[model samples]
Target: MRNWTISGTLTVEPAEQRTDLLAEPVAKALAALESPDAGVVEIDPELADTGAFCEAYSSPMSASANCVVVAGKRAGEVRYAAALVLATTRADVNGVIKRRLDVRKASFAPMDEAVELTGMAYGGITPVGLPADWPILIDKAVADSPELVIGSGIRGGKLLVTGELLASLPGAEVIEDLAKPVA
Candidate 1:
């Protein structure tokens, strides 16, 4: 199942066969999928950030997705969730995400806290291996795309997957207008 739609200077291979490039949780999550038609490609850890990776590999930024961790608090309880949006857009954390988490305030989770909780490297937190209870809000644009380039839970590689695949994750919720186009 190594058929992939995204391309660059990287060699795409079956993710199952390149588990070494994935975070433990991400590898486990993909392994558990009934039809994990995902592909993996190794890269320089320094170029893992969306912009750098896209420019360096000659990949369109629109074909990439970003998974951001958000934190909110209500009644003294902290709630966490992941937001998936196109690289060319920004997640509506203050609007859609805050309401979805039912919190008075929502903000990007701090790097230390996010990495510690997710057990994934900073800048490489994909929605696939999040805590079971954490909702993964995927923007409709991302869900509707045919294919996407997303983090592999580590800075050294990326995963190629379809919108349908991400929408089918354990706690995924595809929502319209979950993100705003960058101006």
Candidate 2:
């Protein structure tokens, strides 16, 4: 695994070092990657949210990337996608994402629906194991980052990966302004 400059107190090891901490699809996805140079760290499930996780782990908020599932409809067909943005920002679902998805309107997917479709826990949906057809819109800021902490498909842990790796995922697209700075 690559050295993580943003790693916190949580010990980061190879994804295989603790498969028990990864979700089924997340583990499979990492295994399928050509390099799988990511690291995994176990954490308190209750602190999975970005704010809590970063604060408790002594990790900087800017070093965390958050993934949110979005839903839209066009011609009676529902379209699903994920937006990845730095913790310091928020995905522009109503603007950039909606336009990119070619939908009249886009909104965060329902908790139950998102979990059911992605097979990931509600608070732990990473972009790694999304449906093959779903597009993953990554903010340019995230792609330019050296390293970031992202969800591990479950609330109990997180994955440490490089921006280049995430930008190379199956359906990933780097967008210049996919997100807006949080106030």
Candidate 3:
């Protein structure tokens, strides 16, 4: 099994060593957590989207995860959560996620709001540096993976982490069926 990787033009480095490519919040979060299994790989910014990144870097779709920010309103107060699901599945936004947030309705956060709040590019909002109060609802499959490739909070790179490392993040909650397989 490849614990470290070098694919195409991307060079993987210990996550702690690639602060230059990490967003400020991500850097701070990683520093606070000090997860040793975390790694990072720099890539062309243009290939930041999941399908493109996997194809260009020779990464399997099964090992890629996507983070989506969602918002819900209850009693006129907005609640937000970050959901992590495998690339092959989609978050159960209207069902499981809404129930978890205790809101009558739930939906993807607006692109502009997600980008502004997360301080990351539209396609690169990662769970790593999410606001401290927002829950990180990670699908069980993602938390069970031996290794996962996820956004690095910037389009220029990706973060490589073990399932345990992801689950250990400050508000991460491993939820069963948090996502349903894509039809």
| Candidate that scores best on lDDT | 1
Q: For each candidate, what is the lDDT?
A: 0.93, 0.92, 0.88
List model 2 lDDT by residue over 1-183, tens digit each.
577877778788998778888888988888899977799989999999999999999989999999999999999999999999999999999999999999999999999999999989989999998899999999999999888999999999899988998999999999999999988
In candidate 3, residue 3 scores what lDDT?
A: 62
Cα displacement (Å) at residue 2, model 3: 7.9
* lDDT minimum window of 10 residues, candidate 3: 1-10
User: Which ranges of candidate 2 are over 4 A from the true structure?
Assistant: none
All models, RMSD in angstroms: 0.8, 0.8, 1.8
Candidate 1: tens digits of C-alpha lDDT, residues 88-151: 9999999999999999999999999999999899989999889999999999999998889999
TM-scores, all models, native as reference: 0.98, 0.98, 0.95
Off by over 4 Å in 3: 5-9
Rate residue 177 of model 3 by lDDT: 97
lDDT of 3 at 48: 93
What local lDDT score does residue 27 receive in model 3, on the 0 to 100 scale? 85
Candidate closer to the true structure by lDDT (higher is better), 1 or 3: 1
